[model samples]
Target: MNDADNRPVADHPFPRFSDQELARRRRAVHDLMEEAGVGHLLVYGSDRSGSAVPWLSEWPVTREAALVITPNGDDHLLIQHYNHLPNARRVARGVEVDWAGPSTMSRVAQLLPAAADQGIGVIGPLRARDHQLLSESVGELVYLDAQYTRLRLVKSDEEIERLREAARFSDLSVAAIIDQLEPGMTERELAAIVEGSYLAEGATNHIHYFATTPMASPDTCVPAQFQSTRRIEVGDILFCEISAAYWGYAGQILRTFIIGADPTPLFVELHDVADDAYDAILSVIRPGVHARDLVNASAVIEERGFTTYDDLVHGYGGGYLPPVLGSSSRPNLPVPDLHLEQGMALVVQPNVITPDQRAGVQTGQLVVVTGSGADSLHNIDRGLGRIG
Candidate 1:
């Protein structure tokens, strides 16, 4: 591990983890490539859509990029801008960059094996234009998107520590918001305070879902918008789904807070149900638990006649990675039937909308599926809180 890995703050924008972690990842993927009989492993990425690319390359590209691994375990990092080479070298340790070019795919096509039986495997989506070009002389042309995604589901030893650090930042930022919340503060103002606290607490990135409604809500099924300009009023219920990122790891925290006074009996009851649902999901989650089985655990709330709304659970890294356990409101696309393996990092959020449809409460925290069970990342209360 390097100093960048241990740094609480994102002092260096490049890959903060060590070269060894990068090597380990490459080795794992190389083994997969060999099994698939691929001569090369190509992963596509850009400033916006780069998922596995950033984690693999140790730095996100400002433009188009790709990380290619050869059969001999040699790794190559390609960038669109030649000028990025210097910075890439600074962070993309132990990788060759000279092969990178603004127009890299066509060149990569030149690297394709002439034999029809040999081919390149890709993890991320490749553009149609580039995809067509690369396939011209390729062999098997394996699409290993799911295979690569599953590889990232489990948290490496280094990634788990970073996630814990990120979660702490989110917790501290939320605590600041609650400690200073007062009547007449605009939603935008409160959001700024909360967002700033993220950076103050050493978070590199923050994604928050913010909502405030006066008294109990009329619709409990929907989460609040990301951020808005609306001003808050007295007796409003504030809610947020806070996701904080450090290095490349993320931890999501969901919380609901009532302003000015004590929550009503109905609200408290609803929140308790939501908390129970959260706990219930955590109880049954462990290595080997079916992904869909976790969803069934939400009955603790829905059985009581509360409306379960929004996405209930998902995996987190880089962005909301896969293994999405589906949403309560949307049943058509529940998470797949995959077993939850140990080392996988997931967020379990069970949201309950009061039966009256006037209030909603959501409680969520990050967890890593353990050998015996699951470990909750945050130490905050699991119930609805108050701000006065």
Candidate 2:
């Protein structure tokens, strides 16, 4: 079967990882299992969402999939949906691929020796029923989601290169929108432009959210999680949060634009504050910097009588990893007691919103932590975009 990219599903080439990278991931998984003292590891996924399955086995989960790893033997990958078997076999590296049968969890249980009593380490989003079945079958089930996240926190050189490609594709998508934005366009049309920018290039969508409201009487603060049918007017302000993916890796970027006119004073103020917060947050990101420090830098928003409706900054690539932070005025979650490490990717977005949550501007993009500081992976212009 061939996908939209004109690449055969069984032998697609754009997303392959090197054998060395795959082996490095395997070693990390084994080390995690040893530290947790588990005999077997089960990585589960549904609807193509789990990060670990792809990181370890190179198989993007489709429908449902599970990977079973043993310390001394070859790893086994069980893919659900009979039709997906051929592609899973071809794409996945260094793992034995097989059909998962009617019940994926039952197949997993049968793989565990009947006489074995060692605990099993579990990762990914297993359903409650499946959790119960695994618990009954094993002596103990060790939840290793956190450890798995830790394994993904630092990107290898190969992973960073993939992220850079994703970021470039993302920039193209944003530029497409800015170039074609018209006063009478609907939010749906805006989304079409975003996907159109990269779909022919074999990229996929992670997320693309929009908010359109008149600058004179702004009613929406943050970008809506879903697109709208509202017709954009001459003086409307449109802001979007978009991520275009290459394989499973994606780059997230947010920007605001004024349609057919210059921004009003209120809109100008919101974007200026957002730009400052974006700069402040990025200036403090480096190896060994605490998560709290990033939030502290965004205090300019609150100090200037503005606040944020979305996370000021967050870990990105491989999943929403950790250290998700918000401004002091609006705490998304308790600041994690984590420090930055080199090669960690983060989205330093500052969705500076009014105190009443009626207006805002979006600014930021994906960046990688380096020896000196954070480096942006995107080349999109960082300004309040204006369209006519």
Candidate 3:
């Protein structure tokens, strides 16, 4: 979505999901659970990525959270820490948000029936201890991770608008970096400045401020968060990854900039190849296309004699969901073979690796799938450029 469409900028500490939207999400989950013969369901997650917690409820999990749903359409939350109970009350509206008493499973067991056919379905990664407890309490716990992923893969209209705002915020963050970036500044200093800019613009959370340059050791195509106190040098081809989150939705922009180096043949070729591969995938993206089809279309990198270093493409909003279109050498197995659906958000970057898993240009764009093709979420130049 463009500023011309007049959407709100991504910023805010709390999330935004209207009552109707929330009802729609719950109904979707309920339908899935009922179809799977799940008598009870648990959507487990934490705040690290806000994985399934925010998706399940507007409530952001501080450390741990579980949204429990019964076949009777009753919804509840087993959140941690008694001190955070007030937070639950404020954010987790309508649900029975109760303190899960350090022993989460025990609390979950209390709310659920002790029947062998209860078939408690779980949707996130669980610790062994928690799993054991759940097993004992619920009898048979079913894995529904993929089912949940499928349910969230196609975002709703409201979600698409929020993602658009998030993407716009991230795009603006890149622009902020260009405006503030200068030599003589340490990567850490640059990170702080960039992060602060996004915060001011209303991003409630930050994804990261990572930087890599040709001068740096271990040239991996992957971008690394700036850690060294060493100052950025001249003549170095640098890559930076910036992402910002509004409420819980995330958007990212990855690009490379030349310090003082002349555009080397290697640099230009890698950037151009990655760009072409990006376009190739874009050319085939639309409703009903298989995810692997996009991965297969991105063979230009290998055809041009370059090793890949990162995921050619992955998703966002659900904090990195599946359908990851990977490199040709190690393409991701699109298990279940998910088809491209409208309103799916993804960040595509063909990170070119130079033989030894060491560095190459890592640039990308965030896009939402459309009926005919894909819409670019961020408005930044795709080609590499020199800061000098």
Best lDDT among the predictions, by candidate number:
2
Compared with the true structure, what per-residue lDDT tens digits does model 3 show for residues 1-388?
A: 0011122323423555666787788788889888888888887876554367677667777878887877575677888778887877766654777788868778887777664575888888787898898787768888888788788788888888888788888877677767777888887877776667767767854565465565445355667754567677776777877788886787788888877667777778888987898888889989898877887888898898887766888877676776776777866554337788898888887787677766588788788888888988788888886775
The residue ranges of model 3 lying beyond 4 angstroms of the native Cα positions read: 1-13, 47-50, 115-117, 215-218, 332-336
Superposition TM-score, candidate 2 onto the true structure: 0.95
Writing each residue's lDDT as its tens digit, candidate 1 over 209-326 gives 7767866444434556655676777678877788777756777888998888778777788788878878888898888888777878887666777776577788876666666765
Hey, what RMSD does candidate 3 come out at?
A: 4.8
Task: Show the lowest summed lDDT stretch of 10 residues, model 1.
Answer: 1-10
Give the residue spans of candidate 2 off by over 4 A. 1-12, 114-116
RMSD of model 2 against the true structure: 3.2
- lDDT tens string, model 2, 1-388? 2122434434656477766787798889999998998889999889988988988877888999899999787678999899999888767777789999999998999888641466799999999999898778765688999999998888999999999999999999889987887777788898899999999999998899898999999999999878878899999998989999998799888889998888999899889988988898888889999999999998889888998888888898899979898889999799999999999999999998888999888999999999999989999899898888
RMSD of each: 3.6, 3.2, 4.8
- lDDT rank order: 2, 3, 1
**Which one wins on TM-score?**
2
Q: Please say which candidate is ahead in lDDT: 1 or 3.
A: 3
